[model samples]
Target: AQSVTQLDSQVPVFEEAPVELRCNYSSSVSVYLFWYVQYPNQGLQLLLKYLSGSTLVKSINGFEAEFNKSQTSFHLRKPSVHISDTAEYFCAVRGSGGSNYKLTFGKGTLLTVNP
Candidate 1:
């Protein structure tokens, strides 16, 4: 499967802060970019996707990411964040080699929002 890897470590700070999570990926054929956020016990939400159109995309919760073709990676970043943003973030890609639509996620990023 097309693989995506996020390099963001542990992001920790006070409530209502700004944060950025970096992500990278490798693919031989065409691919789609995706960002998902995982809450405490929830699965994940479709933050955004870069299919075959724009290079810059944003989510409903103020999170955004850019697709870099040269670097072969997609990075997520936000200027201001909230306690609700505390969760695990993942970067994924769908390989165009075949009909497989499985996503290869990164190790995961932990965003800790403290009061």
Candidate 2:
């Protein structure tokens, strides 16, 4: 089983500033990490993921995360932010075996990008 931890419950950043959302996880088995964003009154949308290939993964909206197995961390970062980027961000992990496709998520970080 895997569990995710989001260090910060809330992050406030000014528009056009750089930001990073810290995330850590613990698991006994191989796991896949993902970041999802949830806007007000909307379902979660996949932001980025680290499954295979390069340890570094990025999303279309300029968010990137690096999978550091040693530290058991997968922190999300963006060079710049926008007010429209404000949302609840969740870090999730799922075991990579059997029929267990359940994703364990963190408490979530509410990113408030102010104008």
Evaluated with lDDT, which candidate comes out highest?
A: 2
RMSD in order of candidates: 1.5, 0.8
Q: TM-score of predicted model 1?
A: 0.90
lDDT string for model 2 (7-96, tens) is 999999999999999999999888999999999999999999888789999999999999999999999999999999999999999988
Considering only N, C-alpha and C atoms within 3 Å, which residue pairs clash in candidate 1? none
Candidates in order have lDDT scores of: 0.84, 0.95
Candidate 2 deviant stretches above 4 angstroms: none
**lDDT by residue for model 1 (37-80), tens:** 88889988889999877899988878889999999978888888
> In model 1, what is the error at residue 82, expressed in angstroms?
0.5
TM-scores for all candidates: the values are 0.90, 0.97
